[model samples]
Target: MENRPLIGITTYLERARWGVWEQSAALLPAAYPALVQAAGGLAVLLPPDDPGRAPSVAARLDGLVVAGGPDIAPDRYGAEPHPRTAATAPERDAWESALIRAAAAARLPLLGVCRGMQLLNVVRGGTLVQHLPEAVGHQGHCPTPGVFTRHPVRPVPGTALAALLPEAELAVPTYHHQAVDRLGSGLRVCARAADGTVEALEGDGPGFLLGVQWHPERDGDLRVVRALVAAAGG
Candidate 1:
């Protein structure tokens, strides 16, 4: 672990029910840290906090992972909330948005998963589809509760994702009702679902900035995490 980079993972502040407890807590799936460690990096949980502290935090981290969670407030991107959109977490949105900005400013490597990807897009002047089924016809993008729908996505050749997965098609674990609609500023689409939903994208800047609609960590897909840690080392 000598050269292990310190990677900060953003968490969700939400209500949970556990053994004799039901209250709001900062939570993140264990898969995130485990995958990061498996990729040879020190994992740190970054719960949403004061916005003013984000830049300093980004300056100290080797990399950042915007973990997946609740829906973004539609108003953040100048849209009305869809009925299917979950309750908004404005504070979390504000904090994570700040983190994204700081990471970009510092040119820190970052990976955004699920809701994380949506927020990253919105924060960068991009828009979201809000509900994928309405636009894509199939709920295969998010088939069932507590289960990940598997689907093939084609990566654009010569993209960072293509380097990791050279196959023409990659089967990914995904569970999301929303997808990226408008392309974000300086962001390039790296992959797309069979139905044409954007599956992954990367920023045009110099550092590693990837956002995927799939849950790579949940199923031990290490390519993306490994790439991020490698970039952090550089």
Candidate 2:
């Protein structure tokens, strides 16, 4: 439907050691696509290969959704890799970073989830906490595998994130360890965890750029997706 907004979902590129293995890795949960569809938006998968073509790819889209994936390379934010840092996909870093910048410049509505949130921060001149367990001294973020636990997020009133889920206390699914350390320029913190970790951020200027550390898609929070689509004005 032309009346409906088009949301571009970013894809991850898995690289093998021996040769260049170009393939579509399922970085986002199935719930993401379902949520977008339910929110009256058409979701398109944007791969990390050849991001120079993002302008052309984004030209047809109304919004952009940066999905979660592997840990980002510390170098992108001016830090050294911790021993606990997982495998860093440089190609993914290069492509997604460029894509985020382009999407921001185009004034497209953007939503970043989990690792997507981290990427959004980095793209805006921010940095990450490298290792949550080492820095935060707690493993509460991710308790077990294949299971999600709800956590309280205090959203700053009058923010896009707050307007989407207007509750005194919002319970969201948690699946990330690292979080925003130094906020990016012109971005404001919109939410935080009990441990003082930055949970949500939005663009300071008059555009839709919201990033959440939780997986709203996994928790079936269609309101957030709907708000993003609405901002797209399709």
Candidate 3:
């Protein structure tokens, strides 16, 4: 087998029904691993569990992808809950948060999508505008469940995302009800929507550490994923 870089992707724990079995399952959208493999990396699904194991997991992987999912518990970031926020997944929150820390400590390349991006920010002393509709004057960020709304995002002139997406602007697949309000420590905004909502952020770390509020996997855009895979190296 070729020495493809191993990419660990976070998953969701949810009550699900499938083929005569209905129970809480660790699930991930097929698009995630599919995109990872397409980018020449081996995909591994990581169910949220004992956070103490994060360092072990991080040490074994070449990169990490914090997949998108439910709203993080506001308490994790010392904020009050929003009426529209979904029920929290404390296990997933703790697990992914620990993974983020471990990955940073190991200087592993990491990519965070949607909720993953928000989690990355929160883990670094940042805050989110829990309900973006009121903050941005529209529900365009997440127009409907199970479907993605489209919008244009521009990459900052000298950022990694800009190099990957050299185009002046990109129409991205977006779905979220929250956004980074205060910049996180050691993080910088790398992309933005026309409405001034943050679209991407990058960390000041040893290797590639990028986060996108948009869904590149769903859109099948390999630029970002390929960049991560290449950074991880085979």
**With candidate 1 superimposed using the best TM-score fit, by how many Å does residue 174's alpha carbon deviate from the native?**
0.4
Estimate the Cα RMSD of every predicted model relative to the unseen true structure. Answer: 1.3, 3.4, 1.1
Tens-place lDDT per residue, model 3, 177-196, is: 89999988999999999999
lDDT of each: 0.91, 0.82, 0.92
- Per-residue CA lDDT of model 1 for 1-234, tens digit only, reads 277899999998888999999999989999999999999899999998999999999999999999888889998899998999984688889999999999999999999998889889999999999989999998898889778878899998988778877999988898999999998898999999989999999987677999999999877679889999999989
Provide the TM-score for each candidate, comma-separated: 0.96, 0.90, 0.97
Candidate 3 ranges beyond 4 A from true positions: none
Error of 1 at 19 (Å): 3.6
Minimum summed lDDT over a 10-residue window in model 3 is located at 201-210
Clashing pairs in 2: none
Best by lDDT: 3
lDDT of 2 by residue, 112-205 (tens): 9888889999988899997787777888787675677778989989887787778868888898768899988989999988888888998888
Q: How accurate is candidate 3 locally (lDDT)?
A: 0.92
